[model samples]
Target chain A: MSSSEDSMCRAAVDEALQTVGGKWSYDVISRLYYGPQRFNQLRRALGGITVKSLTDALRQLERQGVVHREVIPTYPVNVEYSLTEKGRDFRAVLFQMRAWGEKWLPGEKDEKAEG
Target chain B: MSSSEDSMCRAAVDEALQTVGGKWSYDVISRLYYGPQRFNQLRRALGGITVKSLTDALRQLERQGVVHREVIPTYPVNVEYSLTEKGRDFRAVLFQMRAWGEKWLPGEKDEKAEG
Candidate 1:
């Protein structure tokens, strides 16, 4: 490939990584992939993630257009998060990564067997 | 998915990210996708990467079993780097990321037009 094409390819990959490569971004995206989730539901699902981190990740994802935030008119007002079209498209990359990991990385079961 | 299954999936994705998510690891892997490369060739291709960073990234990939290093005997011994089967498998993820980026992220051309 020409140097320009190489650079463009790198740029594109970098953009994808920057969008979902945060500490808690992937975790959030993975959960939301199931369905839309309320903030508390996401917090409980992620376990060990701080409220601030989850909020930050959500906001970043929202800004990147990978996630959509909706406010429901309720007693206390609930905010739900879900993947946008772009975010849904990211599932392919996530699936591929998971598949590669399963094939190459040793799981807890494998570790136990080796031990 | 069950909580256990979710955790396992997350762990797998995390493993893949940790292996290839270094600052220059993706760049290195991208260049090597074309073919095996000498150290200097990779350094030049990567552009702006320091020797130390490149060396560290290569060593990490090597340890992770994603890259293989071979010593070629010539007038002076020369070392070359190439991807292993596991590393080649990573192309799926890379291709997906690139596709997602092209679809979602704005390129320089887009920015120029907008400007």
Candidate 2:
């Protein structure tokens, strides 16, 4: 790539990272990728995440149009969260990261061998 | 993917992020993607980075085996930095990120339009 193109790519990558680079962002998104879930369900699925952290991550993702939040009226109002179309599209990046990680970063088996 | 598989992927992705997710890590790696460079050259290429930040980033990457550092034996010792084979392989993740960013994130043109 030309210098200008390289810079542009860098900026774009930075922007993407900024949007989804939070500590809990990937976990939240990955869970939602399976399907939508009630807020409580999501909270339960992501063990060890504080309520505040999950809330912040969901709100930030919603604001960025990467996540959708819906309120269902019932005896007790039910809130559901899911990946938006944009969020679903982000799977490519996640998949790529996973692939690279699998190749370069040692997994449990590799660690055992090393030990 | 199965739940077990998803969890494994998450672990791998997390490991990858932990290795390259530093504030300056991606910027440093992206700059080196083009080619190797001297310390000062890299520092200048990545404007706004403090010397300490660069030093820390390079050291961290080197420790992770993503970057290789070499010292030239000469009248004045010169140091050079380049990506390892593993680092070069990480371009796929970066490219995927760039594509996602281009699709979703607002660039300068988009910002101007909104303004």
Candidate 3:
């Protein structure tokens, strides 16, 4: 279904991994839940992403069923991206990952584990 | 902390990812949850994994306090691996990923989502 050539299963997992298996993916998608965002807006929200890396991530998510992209079609060519229904469904997973990550993934520790 | 030198956060996530992020990782860990498993047992349990990949995953998980490795030291040498408490904590997340993946991944879908 994608422009790239690969087996159906391999391609699908690869595509899904492209969205989920990375440092900043959940962070980026988590930010987009609020509303549609332009390219620059997303870069601003995701603090340390390089332009190329961010573009790659957004394109990958768009390929999956998770992201919806709208072309603003302005002079310089503006575009807005947001979550699709499937993408929105990932909100719960994202929250779980964040909480679990902060709990276990070093430095974000709350230190208030209930006794 | 265990022989790897990098930024602490980077090193930690890298170590955790070494345990979690891969093709056969979750499958291996999930299988170990049943009980302690020998090396050959794990290889047989995980149908598609190569020896190299399995060995690496086992070592990484061992380092992370997730997979406990007990050496039998028999004639040839035998090793058994099982999940630790922290590793067991990931059971819920693993179940979620498997279910969600089957639902949205390449295959493994249920027709009934309770409409």
Best by lDDT: 1
**Mind listing the fnat for each candidate?**
0.67, 0.75, 0.04
In order, candidate lDDTs are 0.87, 0.85, 0.65
The better candidate by DockQ, 1 or 3, is 1
Query: Cα RMSD to native, each candidate?
Result: 3.1, 3.0, 7.7
Error of 3 at A96 (Å): 2.9
Best of the two (1, 2) by TM-score:
1
Q: Give candidate 1 regions above 4 Å deviation.
A: A107-115, B107-115
Kindly report the docking quality category of candidate 1. medium
Model 2 shows how many backbone clashes?
A: 0
**TM-scores of the models, in the given order?**
0.89, 0.87, 0.73
Query: In model 3, how large is the Cα lDDT of residue A56?
Result: 83
lDDT of 2 by residue, A1-115 (tens): 6778877887878767766678889889988988999988988998888889999999999987889999999868899899988899988988998888877766564785788
Residue-level lDDT of model 3, residues A1-87, one tens digit each, is: 232222333444344445577666665676787789999999987768999998888887887667889998799899999998767
Clashing pairs in 3: none
lDDT of 3 by residue, B8-107 (tens): 4334334444456766666677678778999989998676789999998888777766788888989888878989876787665544444445456533
lDDT of 1 by residue, B1-115 (tens): 8887777777878877877689998899988998999999999988899999999999999998889999999868999999999899899888888888877776554785788
Q: For candidate 3, what is the DockQ-based docking class?
A: incorrect
Sorted on TM-score, highest at the top, how do the candidates line up?
1, 2, 3
